[model samples]
Target: MSSSDLAAVVVTVCVVVALVALIAVLTQAFALMREFRRKLEDFDSKVGPALSQLADTAEMAQAEIGRLRDLLNIAQKVAGLAESAGAATARVAATPVDKVRSAISVLRGAQTGGTGQRGKAEEEGRETGSGGESTAAGSESRGR
Candidate 1:
C-alpha cells in the first residue's frame, strides 16, 4: 500500500484499540462498584443489629451508674447522721438522771433512720441485762 494509506490504517487501528481499552476499564469499574455495594449491604444486615445491641448495653450501663450515684449519696447522708448520733450518745452517757428523757428522744429519732435492726438488738440487750431484772422476769412469766 502507499505510505499515506499505511498511515491512515495505523491511525484507525490505534483509535479502535484505545476504544476497546476504554470499554474494558469502564466494565471493570462497574463490576467493582457492584461488588462494593453488595459488601456494604451484607455488612449492614449483620452489623446493624450488633450496633443496636451495643447501644442497649451502653444504655443499661448508664442506668446502673446513675443508681450507683444515688446509692453513694444515700450512704454519705447516713454516715453523717450516724456521726451526729455517736456525738449525742457520748453526751448522754456522760450526763446524769435528767438526760434520760433526752436519751429516749434520741432513740425515737434514730428509729426512723433505717436503724431498726440496731434498735431491736439494743432493746434485746437491755432486756437480757441485769440492769432490768424485773422486765426479764415478767417476760419469762409471760412465755409460760
Candidate 2:
C-alpha cells in the first residue's frame, strides 16, 4: 500500500472516533436535561400549595395590621377625650361649689343665733341622712 492511502485510512478512523465521542456527549447532555426538567416539575407540584398559602397568610396579616392601626387611632382619641374631661373637672372644682356652700352657711347662721349655729347645722345634716360611716363620725364628734 502507498503512504497516501495509509494516511487516508488513519484520517477516516479519527473522524469516526470523533463522531462517536460527539454522539456520546450529546446523549449524556440530553439525559441530564431530561432529569433536570422532571425535578423542576416535582418541585413545582410539592411547593406550589405552600407558596399559595403563604401569600394568603401575608394578605391576612396586612388586614390585621390595618385593623390594629385603626384600634390604635381610636384609643388615642379616647385618651384625648379623657384628658379633656379631667381638665374640665379640675376647672369646675377650682371655682363655684365652695362659694355656694359658704353663701348658704352665711344664710343659715343668720337664721340661727351665731352661738347655736354649729349644733343647729349638725342636727339639720343628720336629719338629711348621710352615709352610715359619716353618721358614726358625727355621733362621736357630738359626744366629744
Candidate 3:
C-alpha cells in the first residue's frame, strides 16, 4: 500500500485503542464511586447510632462522677466529724481517769503516813515489779 494510506490506518487503530482505555478508566471510576456510596450508607446505619450511644454514655458517666464527688465531700465531712468526736471522747475518758489517779495518790499518801517520798517509792517499786515480771516472761519464752 501507499505510505499515506498506511499512515491513516495507523491513526485509526491508535484512536480506537485510546477510546477503549478511556472507557475502561471511566468504568472503574464509576464502580469506585458506587462502592464509596454503599460504605457511607453502612456507616450511617451502624456508626451513627453507636456515636449517639457513646455520647449518651459519656453524659451519664459525667453525671455519675459529679454524684461521686458530692458523696466524697459528704464522706470527708463525716470523717472530720468522727475524728473530732474521737478526740472529744478521748478527752472525756482521760478526765475521769486522771481524777481517779489523783484520788488514788491522795489515798496512798494518807496510808503512808502523809509521806510523799514513801508513796512515790511504792509506786515506782510496783512499776518495776511489773516490768521485771514481763522481762522474765519474755526471757523464758525466748529460752524455750
Q: Top model by TM-score, which number?
A: 3
Residue range 1-144, candidate 2, lDDT tens digits: 999999999999999999999999999999999999999999999899999999999999999999999999999999999999999999899688888899889976664554365556566766777445555655665554
Query: Per-prediction TM-score, please?
Result: 0.60, 0.64, 0.72
Root-mean-square deviation (CA) per prediction: 18.4, 11.3, 12.9
* Model 1: per-residue Cα lDDT at residue 66: 100
Model 2 scores worst on lDDT over the 10 consecutive residues at 111-120
Ranking by TM-score: 3, 2, 1
* TM-score of model 2 (CA atoms): 0.64
Which ten-residue region of model 1 has the weakest summed lDDT?
A: 111-120
Please provide, for model 1 over 59-123, each residue's C-alpha lDDT reduced to its tens digit, 9 standing for 90 to 100: 99999999999999999999999999999998887686557878878866765543555445557
lDDT of every predicted structure (CA atoms): 0.82, 0.84, 0.84
Q: How far is candidate 1 from the true structure (C-alpha RMSD, Å)?
A: 18.4
lDDT of 3 by residue, 20-52 (tens): 999999999999999999999998999999999
The CA lDDT at 49 in model 2 is: 93
